[model samples]
Target: MSQKAIIEALKNPDAYDEKVFYVKVLQTHISYIFLTGRYAYKVKKPVNFGFLDFTTLEKRRFYCEEELRLNRRLCGDMYIDVLPITLSDGSVKINGSGKIVEYAVKMKELPQEALMSELLKKGRVDMNVMDEIARILSDFHKKAETNGKIESYGSIDTVRFNWDENFDQTREFIGRTIEHQDYSFIHRAVQEFLKNRKDLFRLRLRKGRIKECHGDLHSGNIFIADRIYIYDAIEFNERFRCCDVASDIAFLLMDLEFLNKSDLSNRFLIKYLEYSGEEEDFLEVLPFYKCYRAYVRGKVTSFKLNDPNITEEEKERSKEIARKYFQMSRQYAEEIF
Candidate 1:
């Protein structure tokens, strides 16, 4: 569909004017999120990246359903269903009995402060909340599925691949944006640490420390409503979701530090280790995984600089966010070595 068509669809009064319905646009980044009364509808953008494939109507529908199914594991009562949007002649209608043109995952919207990210920003986050989150995530990881076929996911090769991808893609940006001394320090730290810790990485794999997990478990993806709810998992790619559990937790750790709550981050890590009894293993592989997580954030935010949809001011803001994440990755690497 054309950009104008998409915008028109978004502005369609009939779609939101039903007596029983009310629509509000929530967020429009990688995907479009809309709030319809108590329900939130998420529609995948028609973009084809090698990592994610939402390019076709059929694929979008399939992934929309997949998102509902995967998210239901955590938010069973909140994830309602997946609905199709049909186009006939020139008009669009949701769940119409015509050819499916697009798809959206429908969900019950939670309160804004219920989101851990928003809570952290307002200084409402606390250790009790972190402990609760730790317990919830630990239990989830214990029950998460593991792929018996992918040996690489638990091996040194996976660790190496993570680093190689990060360094190769962000070296130029890091060189340009970061101070020379800071950049060199991080580079030497990563090299030395990886050289000396190859054996530890392999050992973690052999111990079943790697499993399929929430690929993106940062504060933004978690909700604290009576219980911790983690949603919006990596439904489009298995590689993103399947890996060492430490890698999964590292995302949260990186997010906490990014929010300037290092004390809480440390407390959360310790509590998670205490509950899961996996502290030693996590300590061994955490630095590497945390660095990987930070770099991934940097890489993703950097794409905003190239997006035509974003204004110049937004692009500058994205660049600053990307730089912050790159610096965080460097700091994690230095702390490890």
Candidate 2:
């Protein structure tokens, strides 16, 4: 079946195992999420960007399973299972006996109002919530699996490679979403840090700060509910998922700051340090990662301006957000002292 046909088929409440009164579908560039009354099913697009490939049925199935496995680290019960959409007799039924056509990662749906991003927008997030977020993040980092290979990602060379890639990827958006001067400054600042902070990067590696972490650690990926749920981890690439824990921390911190909650970010960082028992030196390397995180956010948001599916208003918003992120990246670069 075609991807569009399968998507249309899945929109029926009858397509699910449990009773669902209605079905709503959300589409991202790489995946489609069908939200039911109690569960959400995510299906990968048969698209291959160089960094991620879900072009083949087998690759989609593999990533569906990988998403379930990796996200189970934080949301074991929420990431329910990986199910196949099968085709038989002109019928497309999920997990039915037929030719496997597509795969989906099924998850228990949580309250949308409880999402960290929503809470921030509603002004419902408090210091207590930030406190819990910090404690949970510290514990997760402590338990995350790490080895020699993971630690190598914290090396200066790898760090340089990532920054260089970010710059190259976003070069086209310089005048559209980011100012040329801001881009040049961020690039130069990152390069200077990589050249002069070899000792600091080596210390992070030696102290074992690298781990298999949640690559997308932002407000949108978190929920403040009965139990905190941090979901939607990066599963397509280990290079993105396995990194210096500081990078993971920086992503969330950059997100809070992006949401105009710099106080929360500052408080979260202090509490995270206290909970993790890391030295004050952790601050020394944080700005570098924060700058990297903000620049990457700018790059990705700017790309939405070119997405044919996104509305023109969304593209305008993306351009505005991307500019803010680049400016924040510049500020962080300036603070790299």
Candidate 3:
């Protein structure tokens, strides 16, 4: 069924047990998030966006299971299980024991204020929270599995490919939405870094600095309730999530800076370094990784222009955001060299 039809069905009282269950659509992006009473059900959208493929029922089920399994590593109590939505006689029901039409990864619904992005926006965020989050993430990274066989991650060729692919993909949107000044600066900086940092990249690889990590570790993906919850891990692809630990931590640092919380960012970085005993190594890669993270943000913001639901004003705002991130990327690159 189409997304609009699914959304419409959710609003109908006849579609569910009204007294016992209620469905509230929370977020609709790559996935559809619904609040079913105390739990949130995340259903993967049946769209193949190259980077994420969940077009088939089997693929959705597989990813749902993967999401539950990976998320349980951090949020064991919160990530309950993957349940199938059954369709029978033109009606859809959760755990109906009928023909499975869709699957959702059920999770304990966390409060909005608990999310780091929301907390930061309200000026309710504190250094203590960042410190705790850093510690939790550091511990998770320490325990993460690594592949001794894969040596490409630490090589200069691979590092160049990462930056090259990012810029090549985003270059088309440069003059269209992103400011020309910002784009020029980023273009120059990326080229300069590629020319100078070959040895450093190889050294990091030999040191085993690369490992499986949380691909998307921004403020929006973190939560601090009774305990820190690092949710929304990249379960769609291993390559995106598997990288240098510095790159993973860089995402959070960039997010903090973007939120205008540099003090918290500093504190978080310091705390993470203290616990992991890798401050010098982190410093060496921090600027480059921050650049990478900022460019990723620019690309994502630029995508808003393609969203039909977004108004012209919103598209303009997204362009401004994209320009700002591109400028930030340039600044990080300059700092590195």
Candidate that scores best on lDDT: 2
Q: Find the 10 residues in a row with the least total lDDT in model 2.
A: 13-22
lDDT of each: 0.77, 0.88, 0.78
RMSD of each: 2.5, 1.4, 2.4
**Candidate 1 per-residue lDDT over residues 1-337, each given as its tens digit:** 5633654585564653233255666543568777666767788877765568888778888888888877887789888889877676777766666666777787878876789888888888889988988888888888877767544676666656666665666666665445556667666777787688878777776777777788899999988887778899888877777888999999999899898899999999988898888957678778878887887888778766666767899888888888888888888877777
Question: For model 2, how does the per-residue alpha-carbon lDDT over 1-337 read when each residue is reduced to its tens digit?
Answer: 7988998999987677678857988877789999887888999988775668999999999999999999999999999999989888988888887899899999998877889999999889888888898999899999999998888777788888888888888988989988999888888888888888899888888888999999989999998888889999999988889898889999999999989998898889888998999885588888898998899888878878877768999899889999999999999999973
Against the true structure, candidate 3 reaches a TM-score of 0.91
State in Å the error of residue 5, model 1: 1.7
lDDT of 3 by residue, 1-337 (tens): 6656655665554544334256677653467787766777788877664557888889999999988887888889999889877777888776766677788788888876788799888898788887788788888888887786444554666667776777777877968766677777777777787678766666677777787787899988888788888999888877667788898999999988987889999999999998888856568878888998998888878877776756899889888988888778878878865
After superposition, the stretches of candidate 2 with alpha carbons farther than 4 Å from their true spots are: none
Q: Which regions of candidate 1 deviate over 4 angstroms?
A: 16-21, 171-192
Q: If candidate 3 were superposed on the true structure by all CA atoms, what would the RMSD be?
A: 2.4
Candidate 3: give the clashing pairs: none
267 Cα displacement, candidate 2 (Å): 1.8
Clashing pairs for model 1 are: none
For candidate 1, which ten residues in a row score worst on lDDT?
Answer: 11-20
Enumerate residue pairs that collide in model 2: none
Q: How many steric clashes between backbone atoms does each model show?
A: 0, 0, 0
Task: Tell me, by TM-score, which candidate is best.
Answer: 2
